[model samples]
Target: MHNPALDFAVNKENKTITIKREFAAERPLVWDAYTKSELLDQWWAPKPWKARTKSMDFREGGRWLYAMVGPAGEEHWAVADYQTIVKHQQFIGVDAFTDADGNINSAMPRSTWDVAFVDKGPQTLVECLISYDDLAQLETIIQMGFREGITMAMEGLDELLVSIKK
Candidate 1:
């Protein structure tokens, strides 16, 4: 598949969503794009919805708080609480919709994200496994257009990766 193509799958029974894509960049670069907020801000959100990091602590038990700003200047905040981080290999975290103060929204679904970066010579394979609290929660977010937004974000990442490779 092309770098812009993603293998997106959902498992309602397992309460999980999986997204796989390959980038024409080294594993280290891909890892950095994920771990560093500076790089993340470049491509984390879909076009016209920029990601702005408020704070990032890249460590186990730490948090990365950010907002997805709309073209009209509206903002939606979220927080990722890192659970495990293995440099250049894998990272696991929980992401939840939150207020600007980083308080998790109990009314919304929370998802655990398990991300893996596999070295493939000049390229890297990125896999993201997102597990929700339940099947209903998974459906809820999917119905809310998570798949389309995230697919667009991944494509944005592909464009960034291509530019950085130049």
Candidate 2:
């Protein structure tokens, strides 16, 4: 089987980051993996870190509150508020770092994510456009190893998709 590639792009001028990845699964299955909290918790975080959802409401105007638990049991929380959803096609949301109680942390950069899913025969192409408030915020995330972290997470997703197909 051919492994799909992951494309990550940074646009400092636009204050945005774009990531494209292909999954060896159909669009609907890929969409479910993203939307369902159960599936998300399974592969959302990279290895040595686990994603634990505190609460989730997967609908427009709803939000997902989750924490990334490090190997040492330390936790970092985040919340994503869903702005729009179009079934298996696309979804838009605003994501921000937060406390476990779900209070947004103003010190951290917030981003708006517009994610699209496109069907490619037996595979699904997932495109994510993440926009930040300014260049400083964009640079902050990059400096924080966003590329490497996301790459690892997506690789985890790849393994997840294969296992779920069984």
Candidate 3:
């Protein structure tokens, strides 16, 4: 239940995980959910886990804070700061865990999450790139439940993409 097989590529320096799915919908619709807070709250985390955002300023120099509720009734707080935002194209941000008050927790390793949207004919390509400094950080992430969590989270995203009720 803890470790799962994640579709990814591991280089000598870092691990790169990728998921490419065609959304029956168009690019704009898929892009909006990633940028907008209301849509993101619908299916950001994996199922069986729930989250609520405290703040979401989706712009350069902006920040978003959220709390994830675990299956065992535990809560983990995470915060992300937007560094660069290119409309309808890309979102580059630094992610970290923090307290409910949104204080930065240094214990959690910080990394940049790069999300890009590319038009695939009439469909959309939602590419998520996560980068770390070196191999050790990559291992740390894997040991910290990264593979299982990302797989579950991406599956949730895949469901949202194929759903017509969005």
Candidate 4:
């Protein structure tokens, strides 16, 4: 099992966002949570929201695309491209909002996200390091209700962790 840690913070200048979580599972299993759509579907969205993973090709040069719709039919799509993958140690990718055909929406800010799965005794430490282009871009996301959205996303991840423990 992994020992999951959970916390997220914006950089002092508000140009970056970092999320840390530990899971009481093995690195490989926890890694699958982020890389595989099957596992993601179980805990990808918080209550009142649902995730419909359009595609998840988690390999270098591959893309991960997903659509998360709220209860009221309001939907959002996101696309991430894998830049690096170091087995169970880490995964780095660029995330952005996109459309059905896997095209960058351009209307959204693009950010680099680095997720590390560190071995800690019998547990695993998962840290998500996200950096934006600038402070203004970060602010734009915040103004559009990012903090709560992110917090809720993390909570969805937590739900997944609990299910694995059972």
Best by lDDT: 2
Q: How do the predictions measure up, each by TM-score?
A: 0.96, 0.98, 0.83, 0.87
Task: Rank all candidate structures by their lDDT, best first, as comma-separated numbers.
Answer: 2, 1, 4, 3
Cα lDDT for residue 81, model 1? 99
Off by over 4 Å in 1: 1-3
Tally clashing residue pairs in candidate 4.
12
Which candidate has the top score in TM-score? 2
All-Cα superposition RMSD per candidate: 1.2, 0.9, 4.6, 2.5
Model 1 TM-score, all chains together: 0.96
Pairs in clash, predicted candidate 2: none
Better of 3 and 4 by TM-score: 4
Name the 10 consecutive residues with the lowest summed lDDT in model 2.
1-10
Clashes of 3: 0
Ranking by TM-score: 2, 1, 4, 3
lDDT of 4: 0.79
**lDDT tens digits by residue: candidate 2, 54-125:** 999999999999999999999999999999999999999999999999999999999999999999978999
Q: What is the lDDT of residue 135 in candidate 3?
A: 64
Residue-level lDDT of model 3, residues 24-134, one tens digit each, is: 456888888777777777667777886678899998999999888777988889988999998888889988889999998876766778888888655677777777666
